[model samples]
Target: MTPIIREARAGDRSALIRLMGALNDFETEIEENRADASAAAEHFAWVEGQIEAQGGVMLVAEAQGRVAGFICYTFEEDPGAFVRPEYRRHAMIWDISVDEASRGQGIGQLLLNAAETHAKASGIGEIRLYVLEGNARAQRIYREAGYRNYERLMSKRL
Candidate 1:
């Protein structure tokens, strides 16, 4: 399928929310062994607001007249917010999601390539992302795209 990748517009809010909910369900299934559909829906309102705010950039993959995947990120001066400066050479992948039906079609790779191209043109150094410990599939994709595991972070609520 020929996937059209383009910057998301305000009109894509609904589709974006749907894709995010799908990803949330996918993650919940991986970790909690349950689908928290209700919780995902509840968070969509706030997520939509954030996507429409400053510094936010969302890209959507459209195939067959529908949105198949999405990547959302924000450019920031403070690399410390999520990654160390040394690792924040250029950009960060805050979130990337491929709808379950669209997995394995190289859509994720296409998105990453587009992001990398954008970063390179902007003269950024590196692209960084955090993959959950158990998400080997995503890790593999990032690794195949030239990202390395430079650090591991651990946290706990006291």
Candidate 2:
């Protein structure tokens, strides 16, 4: 069944906490520099704070009366002198994660679509997100969605 995509609400607190923990664990597994997972509630609260401070939005995919996944994003405007005008204003995805149990489904895509719609409706012309080099699955998903390499971030191990 298709998941219902909607803005997260107060009633989703518990599920949000659970989902955030799952996300942390997933990242920790894939990124060598990532720290071990912490309490799930902290992740939820952190995202909530980002949303409050940055005018961000978190869209959740609800399936079977639970939050199957979520996408958190915000519109950003960089007025730096060196930044080109067209690239100054854009939407950035802070986080997008789906529960392990829901991994094979299209919930992630649904959440992404909802976020893109939200960004476009808010007048954002483009969207961007950061994915770890080890995350081939996520890279493929973004690529399939027409997201391409705009810039490269490389790391030098000390």
Candidate 3:
């Protein structure tokens, strides 16, 4: 199916929440249950706030008139935020998720491509995202999209 991708509207907030929840569930299942529902809710709220404040763009992929996936990204021209100047030369893909039922279809790729196109139009030279260490599927997608790993983000739970 040909998916129509467009900038997200206010009406898409609820659909975005649902898609995020579904994506979290999928990740939980794949990781043998490391996902926390409360944490997901909190993160979603933070995402909403950031969207409101940072002027980032949210792109939604629609199939059959329903939101099948979404991608949120930010363009940076300054080095103030968590994004550094070097990274700012490229768009940052903060979040990208497709519903489980819609997996394996080119929806994710389409979303990423849309984000890249937006970035290029905005004068960004590159794009970047972080995939969990074991997320081979996502890594594969990034690689296929012409992204190469340049850094590792290590974290420890305190």
Candidate 4:
């Protein structure tokens, strides 16, 4: 089914929270990154605040009258504290998730397309996002959607 992509509203909070939980579970399973239920709750709280604050755009893909996926994003600018100003303006995809059952569907792409469209219309120069190191499926989808890795983040446990 062709999912309806729309701006998320207050009425969509519960569905969004459910999707967030699913995303957290998937990520935790893949990486065991301490993404427990409490972490999901905390993330949901942040999302709820973002929704209420309108600091960003939260969009949801609805199929069969239910939310199948969601994407939250915001426009950001940095003064380039020590670098050139060319690295300043960009759109950041804070989070993107599609339910496990909805995988293989086009919901994720639809959300991404909508976000890119919005970024282009806003005159943003670039769109940025982070994918967990082992998320090859998401990386492939992003690459196919015109995204390329520009940097890598690494850490070491002390």
The clash numbers for all candidates, in the given order, read: 3, 0, 0, 0
Top candidate (lDDT): 2
Give the lowest summed-lDDT range of ten residues in model 1: 47-56
State the lDDT of candidate 2 residue by residue for 74-112, as single tens digits: 777887777889779888898888988999788888888
Q: Itemize residue pairs with steric clashes in candidate 3.
A: none
lDDT of 1 by residue, 43-144 (tens): 656544564563455788999988888886654455455867655544566778888889999999988888777666766667677788778888888988
Estimated TM-score per prediction? Answer: 0.79, 0.92, 0.83, 0.89
lDDT of 4 by residue, 1-158 (tens): 79999998878887887888878877887786547555766797786576456456788999999889999887777664764687677788878989888989888999999998878887877889989888899899999999998779997777
Angstrom error at residue 129, model 1 = 1.0
Candidate 3 residue lDDT tens string, 1-158:
79899999878878888887776776676565456444566667777677677656789999999999999887545457776666656666777899888889999999999998888887788877877777888999899989899789886776
TM-score of 2: 0.92
Per-residue lDDT for 49 in model 4?
71
Total backbone clashes of model 2? 0
The candidate that achieves the highest TM-score relative to the unseen native structure: 2
Candidates 2 and 4 compared by TM-score, better number: 2
> Which scores greater on TM-score, model 3 or model 4?
4
Model 1 scores what on Cα lDDT? 0.74
RMSD over all Cα atoms, model 4: 2.0
Best first by lDDT, ranked: 2, 4, 3, 1
Runs of candidate 4 exceeding 4 Å displacement: 48-54, 81-83
Give the better candidate number (1 or 4) by lDDT: 4
Q: Regarding TM-score, does 2 or 3 come out ahead?
A: 2
